[model samples]
Target: MGMSVGPSGGGGGRRRGGSRAPMAEINVTPFVDVMLVLLIIFMVTAPLLVAGVPIDLPDSRANALEQEKEPVQISLDAEGQAFIDDAQVSMDDLPAQLEALRKQRGEDNGDAPQVMLRADRSLDYGKVMLVMGELNRAGLNRVSLVTTGSSDRP
Candidate 1:
């Protein structure tokens, strides 16, 4: 309740004039919770800020790729379905489709487009290599494998 300019105690007590107000003491658990949630969101999305589309990369002992721009990532899911960027591309149509994408990417003027393959750990190497061959044939020689960082616990 706000105090009015009057005797508050209902007696002969006078109100203090322009005295400094008492500091408020309040619980801070909600503030801490909100801060923690923001921290979690930042951590979860930080890695995704990197180049290219997001993919669940397979773990490997090989060294990581160091580049400024994200490559055109290709994913081979558990069922061996092929995805260029985020869109599914049939195996038979991959070379022609990639050629079209390369042209659209201004490879005729700008730097050549690239391909990066992310295969399921259980997937056969032959299929991945076959896709590599197709990418090579399509003149996308910058093809490489995507993998989780060695320091990553997952």
Candidate 2:
């Protein structure tokens, strides 16, 4: 003889023949993998970031002078190729180049082009110093070094 059982006290109803319910928890591995992939993509693309050219300038403790206008960026790569505001400027043409650069900034009140020197630390200080001297000779007395502001520094 077949015996009939009793009803279970569990909250939900029991299905005689049906598919089981799926788990509530979400699969996180795919999300994590996607996140990691995104991180890697960003890392790979980070170096491709266009900057105002790279220059390894020396560290200085003195506060930089305030500029009323944006200063021209001069970069000195390790090879000693000098760049004035991203333009390849020869040392001999520095003064004349700066004159034009100053005019480009508008309102040429005979004001010197504010120069910001960015030289590689490995570069010969002679080149950077020579640029400074030439800028001075070109009548650009205002020069500054671009650095991470202490406030913005990590």
Candidate 3:
């Protein structure tokens, strides 16, 4: 009888040389799963990112303006109550408050700070015009009216 000796014991022991090397390839299944979960979370929350006072905007067929800076938002509810950046303020205090805000914004380029007016769809035209006049008087000449886009029907 001949006896053979090797690195592994030859007495009914399992061979180890045929074993596979530790897997060097990255497992992307968990990574892909985490990415998909993050994508779903962002998709679910994207619409809720636009924060502002809720009011029904009038429909218009106007081109949207290109925004350069954050404009001061002024909202008027259906009851004619005024709000500046979601904070309620009396009509009498609006101009001074707006002027202070403009000064704080450092409007020194000969261009007035832009103000976005968001009035309820049911608000009276006169009330809107009056607010416009107030904004103009506050030295905020670059006033833009915010409205929802609508398609014209024949």
lDDT of each: 0.75, 0.72, 0.84
Each model's TM-score?
0.60, 0.55, 0.77
Clashing pairs in 3: none
Q: By the TM-score metric, which is better: model 1 or model 3?
A: 3
Sort the candidates on lDDT, descending order: 3, 1, 2
The better candidate by TM-score, 1 or 2, is 1
In candidate 1, which residue ranges exceed 4 Å CA deviation? 1-58, 106-110, 151-154
For model 2, residues 1-154, the per-residue Cα lDDT tens digits are 5544535444355654444776799999999999999999999999887556776555555676767777778788888887876678777777788666656763547666677877787888788788888777666777876654344333
Measured by TM-score, the strongest candidate is: 3
Rank by TM-score (best first): 3, 1, 2
Q: Model 1, residue 53: displacement in angstroms?
A: 9.5
Worst 10 residues of 1 by lDDT: 10-19
Best by lDDT: 3
Candidate 3 lDDT over residue span 15-56, tens digit each? 565655667999999999999999999999999876367788
Model 1, TM vs. native: 0.60
Task: Please give the clash total of every predicted structure, in order.
Answer: 0, 1, 0
